[model samples]
Target: MSATAAPPRAAGRPRRTSVVRTELRRGVGPWAGAAVAVTLLVTMYAKAPAWQGRWTDATDTLHIATALLAGPLTLAAGCWQGGRDRRRGTLELLRSVPRGRLRRTLLAVAPSALWPVAGQLLATTVCLLATWPYVGGGRPYLELVAADAVALASLGTLGHLVGLLVPWRLTAPLLAVAGYVGLAVGTYTESPARWLSPAVEHASPWEEPVWWFAPASAVWTGGLALAALLAYAARPARLRLLALLPLAAAVAAAVPVLRLPAEGPWRPDPETTRLVCDDGAPGVCVNALDRALLPDISQALAPLNERLRGLPGAPARWVGGANAPGAGEIGLPDHTMDAVRGRLRNPDLYLNSAVQWLFSDICDSGGVTEADAERLADVHLAVSEWLAPTPEDYGVPVGPGAQRHLDALRAGSPAAQRDYLARYLVADRCDPEEVPVP
Candidate 1:
């Protein structure tokens, strides 16, 4: 019979669906994925900042740390995977039997490229889930997650290409150490490259991860990743030159971030400045960041509110600010535990902050006579002690002069002391320099 036309497909050809699985079974395995997961989790814990009361914060921090810590390991894994054939002395044998050289090269590279990303993403996903019960606002910025994955994937490909070029056993470890140093230097220096290190970003009351960074970082790293993957998989020497096109593209994409000034990868979200209010008197408003803190804050301030119940010009609301809080307004700490992280780790500071806010610049009455200012200054500690008589302020080490004044105030009728205290508080507006005690 006449030879029939060759069948449209070959039965022995490796199916695309099986490539990753085949690579995993033959070379890559759960160990690499597990190592990645453990390393990322450890990094997250070791440098983990106090939780910023936002879901976006939890997710970004996990992935940012994963991006930083997993990078070198991914590079090592890639190097190890890329040199496998050379290490086993099977490169010639594999070349002879391959369905195609590019396909074979891809088969070698696929596992290293994809596995670490999967592991890091899994770790980040687990972290995001942990925040579900506590963090209520903001969606998981999956864009940042995607950027982290691409950055890691690209790192893997670059390392793999480096391994293929230099097949020594030391190549992998040395490359990892070099990668780690590069990361470290990037963090400590002034070059634009430093921002590229995806280490954890501290959140502020006014800002969050910038919206555009997701796309910018993805494009930058993805381009470089494509270039390296193409360079590694290219069968013909001439085709390797094509890698430069993507490399150049990556360089171009990085310019905007590189040019950015030192202050931020975040922009102030207007929502953070809007007032969030509580139910009753001595009203309180916190920025979006501190809204979660409002209940605790209000309850803490209840006693102070009671003291101000009938007083003129007593602050009616407390808000986050450096100043310019309206009249009868109190400004929270400039550091404002508003951005206080991690399970209110600084609650004592928050309380101290509240007390400080009310007492801040209390002696600055603009119209006071010099003599009145001097008189006001004399009793300043007395007024401050009344605001918060905590041990730190009223206890030992206070000067004898201040102690005598405090004792005198305490010695007088409680009624007279209250009358004097009330007079001083209102005097900032009405009588610029009246003292608070008898």
Candidate 2:
């Protein structure tokens, strides 16, 4: 008697087969090893002294890289896993059944490529959380999550398409490497080129109309994803058309949504970037610092500006603190939190440490007693030197003679001091601002 065949599967109803699941489970081990290897590489590089706090700094960047890589790796793995059937000649047996190319490809691709995206997103969150305490926390954790989702979905589709395009074993890795290189080159390019990178723009701390970015990226990534998915569904033409999605997305994002009114004095001066502030800010205030401390800060800066003005070519006009309504403001980027933990442990690039270094030098001189006014002047000199603004630079007016004092400070070795002028020198005399009568 002839061998009996199995019943045909109903149209659009995929046959109940454990083959896809089993293949995915079996293929996961190697990919897991790859992920471990990548993690180790990042960990080793991050611990180097030169890159101190680098792991924290690079966390956001790493999240993007991980997302970008996940798609291709999963696709390759799926393809490799699916290829076994072809090598064994079981592909013909499977194809001979009721399921068409699309359903078969979906069954082959879904488990290997789609399932791993969840794991990637989870890993990204864990990595970011681990870096929070060390670095000033991750950059808005929510943004990272969304970016990862887009990256994984796009890559997964691309990988599946690649798998379908090249049924051969050797082609996937070579393609992956080439694709990675192309992505790297495109991402790092200047002006016109930066838009071409696979990575999305890092959001500005300022709240503006960034809604465009999400949709633009989605449309771009979605198109590619659809193309890739279609390729997996055995539609080559759709995959080719979708290949342009990234570029299209880049073009959309690169074009400014809201152009500045005009580049004139009346126009909003980017130089005077606005400070993040709260209500009843009795004076021009930065949210990053306390309103109560404004008086102390103003007094400390005033004498320094005067001493600097005495020098040749001192700034004709200098304003301390956040600008008044018409004037521009200077503060840290909007991303900086009011409460920064380890930030204090870091060096003070601007004021306190600089003052301390100069005061230390003044103290080292034998038989020279330094008064509060003298110390203030010396620290002021140190600051001018550090600022080192070019001709016509905005800031405190420092003349030529003061520049000489600054030159001396730069040449000398300075001690590590935290509260150079503001806290230590006049803490007792400094008057704190009282809460205003509401």
Write one digit per residue (lDDT tens) for candidate 2, span 284-354.
Answer: 24322223333333343344443343333232332232343333222221212211332322222333322
TM-score of each: 0.82, 0.52
Roughly what TM-score does model 1 have, to 2 decimal places?
Answer: 0.82
lDDT of 1 by residue, 186-221 (tens): 677666666666553545535556777778888888
Off by over 4 Å in 2: 1-23, 29-63, 67-79, 131-144, 190-196, 200-209, 231-342, 347-438
- The TM-score, computed over Cα atoms with residue i paired to residue i, of candidate 2 is 0.52
Displacement of residue 292 (Cα, Å) in model 1 is: 1.7
How many steric overlaps are in each model, in order?
Answer: 2, 10
Candidate 1 regions with alpha-carbon error over 4 angstroms: 1-15, 46-49, 189-193, 197-205, 259-265, 321-324, 334-349, 362-378, 391-418, 427-433
Looking at candidate 2, the ten consecutive residues that score lowest on lDDT are: 429-438
Full-model lDDT for every candidate: 0.68, 0.44
